[model samples]
Target: MTILIPSYEPDQRLIGLIHKLKEVSGDPILIVDDGSGDDYRGIFDTAKNAGCTVLTHRTNQGKGRALKTGFDYVREHGIKDDIVCADSDGQHLPGDILKITEAIRRHRNHIVLGSRQFTGKVPLRSRIGNSATRMVYAMATGKPVQDTQTGLRGYSSEMLDWLCQVQGDRFEYEMNMLLEAPKAGYDLYEVPIETVYLDDNKSSHFRPLADSAKVYFPFLKFCASSGFAAVLDFALLFLLQWMFGSLFLSVIGARLCSSIFNYTVNRKIVFAGRAQTTARTSIPKYFSLAVAIVLLNYGLLHLFHVNVGIPLFGSKLITEISLFLLSFWVQLKLIFKSA
Candidate 1:
C-alpha cells in the first residue's frame, strides 16, 4: 500500500511523522507539497533524502485538490496498491496509520477510516463542530459515523477514480466523501485510533464558519426546497377548500400541485448527482409516495378536525408539521437513494 500525505505550509512535525512512518513501513510515501513555497523547500529536500516521492503544486490548492493530485499521480504511474491518506498535522500517529492500512488490506473493497473516540479533554471547537456534523450527517444520509472529520482514511485502488471525481476543494471535500460513500456503493469500516490534539489543534487550517457552511450547504438547500413546497401546498389546500368546501378535492389538488414542485426541486436541486436510479424509475416511486402521503394527510386532517374537534386550518397545520420530517427522510433514504 502507498501512503499519501497532503502538506501545506507544514512544520517540522510533518518531517518527524515521515521519518517515523518510514521506520514502520517499507511502502512508498508520497507527499504533495501544496505550495509550501521556497522556505519549506529544505524540509521537502530532507524528506526526499529520506526517501519520499514529493509532488509539488506551484500555488497553494485546497486539501482536496492536493489529495486528487496524489491520487492522479498514483493512477498515472499505474500503482495498483491501496492508498492510505494521513494528515500531516501530527495528530495521526504512525501506529494508527499502520492500523488503517491493515484494515484496508483486510477489507479490500471497503473505505477504512481511522476513527478517534472523543474522550477526555477535547478542544471545545473540535467537540461542538464534530457533534453538529455527526448529527447532520446522520439526518441527511441515515448513517452513523463516529468521526466525520478524521483525516486518516484508507481507500482501495479501485476507489481512486471515484475519489478524484467527488466534489469540493477544502474540508468540505472530506465531508462529501462520507456523505456520498453509501450512494457510491462503498462499505465503510472504522478502526479505532488515538486522539491526539497538538496545542488544542491550533495548527489545523480549517476555517470553521466558511467550511462548515459548505459542508452543511446541501442539507440546508434540501430544507429550503421542502419548506417552499410545504408553503405552496398549504396555500393551495386552504384556497381550494375555501373555494369548493370539499376536503378530499382540496387535498388532491394541493398535493398534486405541491408534489410536482417538490419532486422537481428535489431531483434537480436538493439531491442532484446523488440519484440511485433514473428519473423514469424514481418518478413513479415519488408519485406513489405523494399519493400515499395525500391520503394519510387527508385522513389525519379529517380525524383532527372532526374527531378531535380542532378547526380545519389548525388540523391542516398540525398534520403538515407532523409529516414534514417523514417526507424528507423518505425522499432521502428511499426515493433518491443512489442506484
Candidate 2:
C-alpha cells in the first residue's frame, strides 16, 4: 500500500509524523504540497529528503483536490498499489494507518475507514462537529458511519478513478464519497482507531461555517427543492380546500400537481448524476412511490387532523415529516439507483 498525505501550510508535526510513519511502516509515502508556498518549503524539503515523493500545487486547492492530485499521479504512473490516505496534522497514528491498510487488503472492494471512537479528552469542536455530521450523514444516506470526517481512509487501486470523479473540492468531497459509495456498489467497513487530538486540534484548517455548509449542501439541496415544492403544495391544498370544501380532493389534487413539479426537478437536476435510470424506468417507479406516499400522507393527515384533533396545517406538516425519510430512501435506493 502507498501512503498519501495532503499537506497545506503544514508545521513541524508533519515531519514528526513522517518520521513516525517510517519507523512503523515501509510503504512509500506520496505528499502533495497543495501550494503550501515557500515558507513551508523547508518542511516539505525535509520530508523529501527523508524519502517521500512530493507533488506541489501552483496554488492551494482544497484537501479533496490534493488527494485527487495524488491519485492522478498514481494512475498516470500505472501503479497498481492500493492507497491509504491519512491526515498530516498528526491526528492519525501510523499503527491505525496500517490497520486501515490491512482492512483494505482484506476487503479490497470496500472503503476502509480508520474511525476514532472519540474517547478521552475530546475537543468541543471536534466532538460536536463529528456528531452533527454523523447524524446528518445517517439521515441523508440511511448509513450510520462512525466517523464521517475522518481523513484516515483506504482505497484500492481499482477505486482510484471513481474516487477522483467524486464531487466536491474540499471537505465536502469526503462526505460525497460516503454518500455515493452505497449507490456505486461499494461497502464501508470501519476500523476503530485511537483518538488523538494534538493541542486541542488547533492545527485544523477547517473553516467550520463555510466547510460545514458545503459538506451538508447535498442534503440541504434536496431539502430546498422539496421545501419549495412543499410551499406550492401548501398553497394549493389550502386554496383547493377553501374552494371545494373537501379535504380528500384538496390533498390529492395539490399532491398531484406538486409531485409532477418535484419529479421534473429531481430527475433532471437533484438526483441526476448518482444514477442513470432513464425516464421510462424512473417515471413509473417515482409515480408509484408518489402515489403510495400520497395515500399514506392522506391517511396520516386524516388521523392527525380529524381523529387526533390537530389543525389541518399542523397535520400536513406532520405527514410530510413522517414520509420524508421513506421518500428519500425509496428514491435513492430504487428509483434513482445505480445500474
CA lDDT of 54 in candidate 2?
Answer: 97
What would you estimate as the lDDT of candidate 2? Answer: 0.90
Candidate 1, which segments miss by more than 4 Å at Cα? 231-256, 276-284, 287-323
What lDDT score goes with residue 283 in model 2? Answer: 90
Encode model 2's per-residue lDDT on 180-276: one tens digit a residue. Answer: 8886778999999999999999989899999998998756767877998999999999999999999999999998898888888877777777668
TM-score of candidate 2 against the unseen true structure: 0.87
Q: Against the unseen true structure, what C-alpha lDDT does each candidate score?
A: 0.90, 0.90
TM-score against native, each model = 0.82, 0.87
Tell me the tens digit of each residue's lDDT in model 1 across 43-108. 999989989999999998889999999999999999998999998889999999999988998997
